[model samples]
Target chain A: MDNVDLLISRFLGGKSSAAEREDVLKWINKCPENRKSFFLTKEIWEASSICSSEIISEETKQWQTLAWRIDGLLQKEKIIRRRILVKQFFRIASIVLIALITGWSGHSLYLRIKSKTTNVGYEMVIASKGQVKEIFLADGTHVWLNSDSQLKFPTEFTSKNREITLEGEAYFEVKKNEKSPFIVTTRTHKVKVLGTKFNICEYPEDKIIETTLSEGKVKVLAGDKIVDLLPGMQSRINTETLDVRVGQADLDVHTAWIDGRYEFRDKPLEKILSIVERWYDVKVVYPAEMKQMCFSGVIKRHKPVNHLLDVISALQPIEYSISDSEIILKKIR
Target chain B: MLDENELVRRISDSDHEAFKELFLRYYRPLALYARKFVLPESAGDLVQECFFQFWLNRKSFIVHTSLKAYLFAMLRHRCYHELKKKAALQHYENDTLQRLRYEEWRYFETEESIFYFDLIEKTKKSFDKLPPKCREVFDLSRQRGLSNKDIAENLQISQKMVEKQITKALKIFRNELSDFLPLLIFCVSQLLLVVIRKVFF
Candidate 1:
């Protein structure tokens, strides 16, 4: 119980004036003993703060929520393991049967099927709901895959070309190589590029596949149409009609997810909720009337889903109830 | 209770019970520690993220120090990332630099933070020995973050009395700490040896 000890205690309690705080800091910097003693007192203060029942109850609730999420992850992993095993068995069995009928070696037939599928030596990287994954290819191309998306790429690129297939959404920074062009194939369109940065968003449920270029050049092909896109340009291909439309790109809206955020500008509530669903890994059920309700705001992807819904409800006349895995939204009268 | 090393070994073996035990013990304290830097709402998420990451990388996660030290270090790293991200969004250069300076001060002082793990248990035991009124006053000052004057007025006590109780509580904590002084000296000497080797080698 010295004057400086009291000052350090006041500082740790966040009650010291700025001058007093500076004095405490100066004392701590005076010697290692002073620093150690300050930290020791600070720890006793913090540990005593945890002895209250309020914290224990809060701790129990938080643990349950975290435990539930961990359980879900474990379940999903088990299912993925089972699915891979079954798929591998079927793949090998079919390859053997086809080889016998065609009078070819099993190894050669396996190679033929692999080449036909274009996945012979490819590795699949998946980003589950509420998660984002980054992958680096052999050619030094970087991809930021969005949630609920998968990318298939070879372990090493062939001398002639660098190719990858995308099923959901990804942002790419392709390494520049003139001799071997980088190409990305989605279900609806194929994008060819050479040393460029771009984002491709083509979720299967969406009606359009959009590619936004941030730097350099890219050529997007859909059906028989080929369009060259410069930086600050976007190409949207209609999944059903195979028509391509090029327009000025909104870089913020397209690439915000890379920074763990989503920007919506007066978009329909339905569209926003769909993105929110993927962002939180939770299903949302709402009345039909609210479908056309438009929302315009930016939502951070790392926050709890309730925080997002609370902000939305404050702006609009709506009420949302959250369950274990679903959010039910009701229109407020 | 299982030892810290034993818990880590079991965790790497994917023993859910060991993970749960560790989470139960550390989650609250870690979350409270994070609140020193982040908003209350985001602190829990940040802590949970660390646990999830630890689980995912269990096989490859190496602990050169104790598990408690390793976890606190990880959470501190995450908090720095979070602060930088917010700073990036605001794009305020001075504000970012100011926050970084403040954090760096604590970062340098944090080596002794890991030493508090066992001290915390001993402190909790000593807490129950404090007079009921003294414990209440200290809780108001520490847990509720109330000023001495504010706590005095709220509890209808004098400001001097409030300070006296808090001072008394600190005395008990220091006495408890003295019991661990020998152990602390040994640990510090070991750390100094390692640092000396690295610098001279």
Candidate 2:
């Protein structure tokens, strides 16, 4: 080994004096090979580590996976909140759907969003079960919060961002604010928009979040994955698996809920039951893991809960009984 | 040195990349340190537990020392718990042996263990980069503990050539390790590797 090499080794160990450090730097600048060796030694494990390259790589991959898993966990915890209000029902979306033809502001919602001023800085808008509420924000943006949903919004939009967090389902007709883009954050994603009309369905009880845009544009940012939605597109996010799927939005089917109607396009019976339970404020207990039994069609919000159940039973080979908040369903023999 | 304060700030905001940076910096040394107290099989788990707790609870830390010192201290305590747990599982007659083993580990300390593992790994890598003929001669002389004359006879080269090849390998190692600090750091690691292999197996 060269004399400079010894000096360099001493420098790397942090045991070198100022004179030794200067000598190492002088040697490094003397040739590129010396510099290369120096830098390589900094990152490269000792000679012994060379034999364990496979193990090191495997360990690196394991650590990376753990970090990502923790990232997903943190996001999930932020989105799923527990407390909910049990309030009297005020059904009014049937009229709001009719008012849809009268410009953006006049697109009446079934009066579901009830804004209760909480603290000084944030406003909590909650839509109780069996109700849908329309909210007109300070910035002329209109929001329709679905039943059993919660939205936390700042009392006033900051000069830079019109930000709000959603937990269930909502349709936003964001008043065009190019300078202040509207951002809707769920547990795992941030949907950014510059004055757009879109419906977001993210009920905690459901496994997937469905976003269907009717007008303008929105971009959903989930971790490193970004999905852009055009007016005619729908992006479905599987929360548990953290997968994003994009397809044509049967716009009417997804937006039907905002219009005070239940529209299912061959959706599974399990999902239909959950939606029914939330809409009418009742629990439907069916067979465990019943995803194969899919139901389709539209039911107006005003339809009697029993009538809907009867319609369901008649169409599928299923029988049901209702007792208080519970509706038990069994397949016909 | 990695900026612990900056990493803590980024980690508090739930930055995956920042956490990964810390993981990469300390993982191997931490794993090797844990191995001194626990079996090689469980060493990884112990190191992983230490890092997981450290990264997950970064926001709650009140750092009074360097990040490396903090991690070493955390790893030290982890190894103690691991040994204590292992002691709990073993028969009482072997209890003294295990306790003495823990003391031996503690006396050796963490810095020397990390320094040794790194030096051995670096030296082995440097040695491996030699030309095939040079590597054969040097490996026979140093690794197989063959005399220079024996290495020359085994490799069908002159004793002088064997010494030359070994010198060439040493020269390359010294040059490559020049930027590294403290030459003596390289000695114990190679010795310790053999000792560990013998003891563990």
Candidate 3:
């Protein structure tokens, strides 16, 4: 038994022969106590090797930081949820009001987009639910508008510069003209480029306005902060904080909507479901647990919303039930 | 004081108290474990982030294993990611060897490793009870990875005396830890009971 102790110590101290190592392994497997002692000794040995001298001080500080973050996040989550509820209520009320004023049927209001020339000599294009629209500007720029989005532009390009207003998401391939810079204005940001291919997303419900440049250079201006984004770079502007973050852009994921697919890499389920809600025109009601659960895959836009839900349910232990235009997700034991 | 399964359920239900309980229970051990793979400065951040993410994904996080095991697994994954990021940023030194060593530890990882912080504390208490000379000899052998002969020579003691001290230390560890095991098993079984009830219910 004492010999076994020596062997175990030798093994842990990195001085054990191969034969002694095997012997120690056999003894550890011999009984639960042996295994426990083996682990206990290893834990002590590893703990002793930690070079940090200020462990206790650092631990208290870290705990405080975590506690503060948790408190802040909990408050933020509650506010965001309440805001979302209020926004949804107003959205439904406005839709009903628009339907009444235009004398349009409810079905038509739910599914049809309108592009009208206003008396101010500007064109306004709105993409309805479950629809994607492509438009060609007079300056020869091509724009692909995503579902539930709005784009406003002048009927003709002015001599100084071409400027347009957008809400929600759009992918643009601008016609190059050095003299005339193309500018897209959204609620929180303005993207300026001489001529470049890029994707901009600024959904009103979202907290961020994301712009991904695929080709050429573009300048993203959030209030006074201006950042030049080169090809394959993305900029995220926080609408509330107004902080801008720039990073390497995943072009495929950003531009996948133009190709009739939603390609995501480790994106949260809540974010994906929100997009799904826009694409399928359904209201998703999921528990809070879905917030940080992530999924990665290609979801074809042509398929029914059930196809995407089925894919999610298969990968996760979640069960879903669909009503007329509402879906409920529940955790499955 | 609730069982892990109950705590997870409550956390999924957005019970902040349950989340706090879970964090306070696991934070020290997880941070210690993460320090094995990454820098000490990053270790605390990594573990904290893991807990935050765990809380956020509580509803969808279906644990096929023990919650302790799952937490360690997530921390390990995050440590790997952090190492990869650091390697990419530094670009001068090759972190492949460090990464390989990090991967090697996965084999020896037991769910029991989560008890490291408590075990080490108890071990230190028991160690303090030992005679000073015996403690010194054992510390040299374990902490510095010194050979028994080298320890004996460093302390100007006979090699046989060094061996005897180490054996004595191990025997005390065996006894001290054996007395603690039944209690550990009882707690573990209680956790298992909660998990079984959750699964079958």
Candidate 4:
């Protein structure tokens, strides 16, 4: 063994004979290097020992604190989730009451509309500017429509199939029914799902129709072609050619609006502004020949549209104008 | 002015005052020693834990020498266990011990044969620069693992004088070692960065 190792062993072994100990002391005195090594090792060991002791103890204390805090947070989360589930339960239970009331007061009106309608069980819901609506389908599917969007579905689905037509964007949580397949038909393609939750965005002016699947399985169909998707997957369909591309999905970004937040993950400047305009019921126009920008973050949806604009402007040099219902953006060169 | 034996006895009897005295006496040296092997944030925690353990298990304490050595031994054992736990968690890469061994072997065979010899020479020069009696006392106490009493008996000095000299020596050594801090920090930071990267990404 080297002199340092020998010195360390002699110091720590704790059973050195008197003669051996004397000999080690003699060696230490004879050479300054041996003494230096000994002192250095001792100093290092002392430092290491003290440090590890403190770290373990401090971590233990911090862990206790964190455990308590996390317990309370988890309890709060459970309560919130439970409350949401109860609200949904009541809402579903009250659907029968709504149906009964509509049937009782509007029987003649339904007869007039039903005689004019060639298709049975087909219903269309359209929301104009500054309008928000919620729909509870016969199959227990729930949809929340943003402003200026349109959704078409059947009042009651057939035993074998459930389908809907879409224009613009809608968030959906389909009730699980394996015997009957649920499909959403957009401008360019169809999303066939069996007990899955997803969002479909198919605005007419937009060039792309995006479908983001949050859970379960979904199949995106374009004419005879089909593409299957798993959870955390997104399928983007080109409105012009109906070509489809699949990629990983960021659920928090896609579903943030439903949770009263606007989340963007590297989205183009144009796309973000359009979403902001629709959700806040405003119009945003940018400079005609400016460079495009992309951003990734979350903003409170309830915040004024200008607040979000200010945040974006701080990231890059930009200016904006807000009128009664119109907002314009310009790049600062 | 109480002797080491009395201090240990009082500590073992759940004497908070004595424990606090022991803690204050050894806290600096132990913290400095621990900072050599662990991150600064963790070093403080380790020192605290060592003292806590010492207090918790004081009833079973056994000491044949200065309480300093016993506490040092406990801290060393805890450090080894901490390193072992870290090594276990990082199964994909070479551990610090293995890397040190490999470097030592390579040093023995390569043109860097005199590299460690040069380091030893530089270290010896640094030691020679210290106060003579302080160096002598530190050498005897550390190299031979002698108790302060034994050091006093052999060097023909009082035990209190020996402790004083040793404390002075440690302070000088800590100041002198500051130059090596950057290299030490780099190695530890690299290890931590690797572990964090693996776990998070």
Identify the candidate with maximal TM-score: 1
What is the C-alpha local distance difference test score of each model? 0.80, 0.71, 0.79, 0.66
Pairs in clash, predicted candidate 3: none
Comparing 3 with 4 on TM-score, the higher-scoring candidate is 3
Clashing pairs in 1: none
| Candidates ranked, most accurate by DockQ first | 1, 3, 2, 4
Question: Looking at model 1 chain B, which ten-residue stretch has the lowest summed lDDT?
Answer: B192-201
- Candidate 1 docking DockQ: 0.14
Q: Which stretches of candidate 1 lie over 4 Å from their true place?
A: A1-43, A52-58, A95-333, B59-64, B90-93, B96-102, B109-113, B116-119, B144-159, B178-201
For the predicted complex of model 3, DockQ is 0.09
Q: Give the lDDT of residue A167 in candidate 4.
A: 86
Model 3 deviation from native, Cα RMSD in Å: 44.5
TM per model?
0.43, 0.40, 0.40, 0.39
Writing each residue's lDDT as its tens digit, candidate 1 over B31-149 gives: 77676567666778888888888888877877797788888888888877877676677763545443532353254334544545565667677888888998899888876767899
Please give the ranking of all candidate structures by lDDT, highest first, separated by commas: 1, 3, 2, 4
The 10 consecutive residues of candidate 2 chain A with the worst lDDT sum are: A82-91
The clash number for model 4 is: 20
Q: Isolated chain A: TM-score per model? A: 0.64, 0.63, 0.63, 0.61
Q: Place model 1 in a CAPRI quality band.
A: incorrect
